[model samples]
Target chain A: MAEIRKATGFIDWLDQRLAVNKFIKVMMTEYWIPKNINFLWAMGVVLMVLFMVLIVSGIFLLMYYKPDIKLAFDSVNYTIMQEVEYGWLWRHIHGVSASVIFLVIYIHMFTGIYYGSYKKGREIIWLTGMALFGMFSAEAFSGYMLPWGQMSYWAAQVITNLFGGIPFIGESLVVWIRGDFLVADATLTRFFMLHVLLLPLVILLLIAVHFYSLRVPHVNNQESEEFDFEDEAKKYLTGQKVESKVVPFWPVFLSKDFFVVGVALTIFFYLVCFHYDFAMDPINFEPANNMKTPAHIYPEWYFLWSYEVLRGFFFDIGGVAAMDIGLAAFGFANVIFMLLPFLDRNTDHVAPAHKRPLFFVWFWLLLIDMIVLTVYGKLPPTGNNAWVGFGATITFLVLFILLPIITKMEANCKCNTGGCK
Target chain B: MRELKILAVVIFFTAVVYWGVEPFAHSQMHPHVAPADFAFKDLGVNSKKGDAAKGAETFMSAGCIGCHGVSSQGMAAPMDHASASASFGVVPPDLSTAGAIYDKNFLAALIKDPTKALKVEHKFNESRPHPMIAFFGLGGDIDQEIADIVAYLQSIAPVTPMSDKQVFADACQRCHDIKYDKLMSTTDKEALKAYMGTVPPDLSMMIRSKGTEYLTTFINNPQKQLVGTSMPRVGLSEKAQNQVIAYMEKVGDSKKAEREDLGYKLIGYMVLFTLLAYAWKVKIWREVH
Candidate 1:
């Protein structure tokens, strides 16, 4: 009896240290996540998982890649064609995952914007998330150059020169980033180190901080006001108390996430395995030949919008030189979206029809403008057509500059009339 | 729980659709191929005694020496054997094997017509590696000079045998001579005069082949037209002329300037770019935030 008592005591002590409740206790008891969070709220978790997938795959790639501009393209090719088994597979997965991660993050950002998650207690979280997003973009930019292919070479050349548009220090800044005049071995190696090591380390730290901030304040589930919790529970899950609802993560959300991942993986795999293409051109394999410029120069898709915006101003009000200013402005505009919650004082935490009339109209308008710019980005330039540019400028002003003013005016009027709650 | 499940499915689909398709959709999916025109498969090395001296001369004068390195020790890059085996690519031909690989007549013909060389003998399995830039002439006449060059190549050393010039280069203890005046004068004054007097000589019909240094000096200096030379004095400044002259002896006509210029231009642009990037970071992004 005495020996059995001693064994039970040890078992109890182990349970205290390792049980699910033990770990869950700190998160569940101290963290302020609202009990009412829906599956829509689970995107944060999904984003986190996608991030993990990218980091692991990225580390594997680093082991085989050589970043000297002379050898980078060939090294990537070597990886895909000769080096690692399923190396190409991992590379594709990582790339496709990047796009997916961005898409989810964008939606999450906008969701926060729509629901005022960036207001009040969540402002720090908002700031941290934006920082992460910025870092993520930098990571992508550096990684894109890792292949050192034609597109990678030219894209780095074009974007790095974008810094040259600055009034005084632009050219110097670009040189600093490049370490040499052209995107050569130095640029390749530096970017590789940053992509594979530095930026990722920053992201990991930032993501932890981002989540910690999220835990300080419970999530805002204000959108639930429209649904009668009791009635919805009965209709959806058979008379369960709204707060009583829960499910095992492993076979439920995890299964769904896996299914989505499977489909995505299939598409990525097919493209990489069957339709393999590196960004390099065989001519580019010789080395960077300055005498010959590739006939077409465009940035990667992630940077297309800013590239198009810069091009739009090339011959408009600005000459080729001043176009940098316009490009700078365009890039600056995205940053504005990131910093908006701090500027706005409203505390409403729902994507309701009312509280933010100005925000929604302008939101969609900016999106439409981006789409238009993207399409226009595909067109060849015609120097004589002032009309088209004037039209675009007017459209831009109306959507971005004018509409916000008008919406604000309308909001103030409604508030004065005591219609705002 | 069920409503949560529904939302999860929708989110999942949205994610899937947003991220998939591009890698599958692009045309010409393999790493891009240089257009068929750029692959010079038939390019064979020059191998004629009549023109061997001239071919050697041309090789040195044209800046090919700068990139290929002295005695073809191989400088810079892309010195791979397999790539080297390809008949022609962007990289210039290795002069060391010129004797064994090509006939003197073929070398003369290539000098006469680069495009023809690119299309024919220089090609290995594909097309030309570089578009045939006409450093010789666009059009006119070519005949006897080629024959003389080939004859000269054959008389001195058969294309199949290791030539005396290659042997001289290997045997001579190379020195850094400050005897620039002597070296320059050897080809500078007389050779340039001869080359300039010829004015884009008929490469296809060489009567007697001259050295590349002779041709380069002549091209750079070309005697005054009033002085009875077909080559005009382009009024090249002393520094400019000497640069071309020293270049002939030392580096020759490789891509040093081109690469250097690009580096400078890119640096200039980068400065401008960083300023604007900072502006976006500060003036616009910061203010808006």
Candidate 2:
């Protein structure tokens, strides 16, 4: 009887642990996806949703698509035109959502960058996000080829050729990548496999890590405090709390997030239903023919900024090989940006707003310059493009390096006045 | 530890299977002439002056000569070559006479648009097989090159035949093939008299009476052409109309499924999609949190 009673007691203890485990699991879910997150904070969730949509829709598309250059285009048409019911709709949804999701994520990243979301313990999350962005771009690049359209063919040709520009093993690397001498059946098949399967799997694992890292430290909403007249007056004169107060996560703050998500979804639905945002141009409907060059070759809008940058330096070089080398370096430099978090030297410095004023200012200036350069990147090829691109690059460096210092100075100015206290 | 081991084992097995299966299937499937690929390649090629000689050379050098005979006779269907003959597991039409019998423009249009070609040719007799397959649009200046080849074929003096439109109205338009099997062989005037004698119309100028627009529309959308008629819609091929019109504007006469079972299949899918959409909206599993 005593043994039975002890067993029961043990069972109760086990049940208690299980209950706690269940609670932790629930909390983790909400923690990873914080409630009452603003639309800006919801960028991670949006990216996650977009990734799932791409994978699932891509799987359905893969059913009818032939990935070889010879048959890839036809298979795509078959998916769109024949066989599956409403297959075109799925493909378009995947394509359009990709652009929208990435656009939101970029905004999220920049906002974080500007507001010092990468400061102190939050560096890991920002770093993971940048890595995800790079991978997302790669995913987009691979998926573009599955359509086997004119632009699809040329874009692959141009980008893959960039790898060949890497001295020494460049030519062999290109051959190895394409599985053929050119972007042919082998290239299409490989790209389709990667786009639909491999990249997505990697992205999912990375996202899991990204969110896990985010959960370690709750969202720092210091940026949400707008510069107000009252705050300014209090800082200079009375030194009272003048900014709009932060509400708790359960109700007030959380409801704002819900409203933003609802609005975003409504706009997304409108784009899907009425606009059908994916490109379905007549030229795109045509299959990729390697022998012929397309009239205009441009990357998708999200990559347009980088594409513009690359094109800006297309002409200026000491030699043909040197020009190619320059292009290759620019592409590599993008990947380097992903490593920024680890590269940051100064840490444990409080009042980043005051201490890093120059860094913040220059970062903002660099961002604007990059945007301007990207715009100029779209212009017709000319000798002057290089000069403009170089100037823009200089602007980029100044902002990236100086903005942190500017923000730090501002934070120091506030502290000295006893405003922070 | 046990669960982790099991998961590791499962993952290992999965990886092994994926690596083992993917390479073989993908490598084997890589080189084949997917119908879409063939169609798009054909579209990219200009058919106006298709030089059988130049095409023959390309066909040979591209490894097409291996399966397709030197004389242009095709072989068994393989990955690289799309054997129309191998389709339906029978001896199909010969290509040697296709240029002569079919209009040159029709051939070009077939290369441009396969579905449109099938729908047009399917009109003559429902029993006649149509080898319609997938098509991919192509890039490059393939059209001009194909035009050169087409010109070469024309130089060969390929024998041309009576246009399909001419033969159809004269020989087979009167009796509806779908409705009356016994009257299937009946010609236009006789069938017309049998059906409506007093208002019977002459078939010779019927094409001229209807303008190209009307004829094209009539040929493309036959359901809208003759209401309550048992004749299947054998749509007009763009090439056929273009070539036939150029060849002989002076001659030839032109004259004109299981609802319940198909409906159920369509309705079933609609219901399924609706339910799926509702499920996505509700996200019932998420509510547990």
Interface RMSD of each: 20.5, 18.6
Candidate 2 residue spans exceeding 4 A from truth: A1-38, A224-258, A277-282, A315-325, A342-346, A349-360, A383-390, A401-421, B1-289
Tens digit of per-residue lDDT, candidate 1, span A287-347: 3444446655654444444455566554444354547556665676557666665455333
Docking class of 2: incorrect
After superposing candidate 1 on the true structure, give the runs of residues whose Cα lies further than 4 Å from its correct spot. A1-20, A27-42, A114-116, A222-289, A316-321, A343-345, A353-358, A378-421, B1-289
Question: lDDT for every model?
Answer: 0.49, 0.51
- Chain B TM-score against the true chain B, each candidate: 0.25, 0.30
Error of 2 at B72 (Å): 34
State the fnat of candidate 1 relative to the true structure: 0.02
Interface quality of candidate 2 as DockQ: 0.02
DockQ scores of all models, one per candidate: 0.03, 0.02
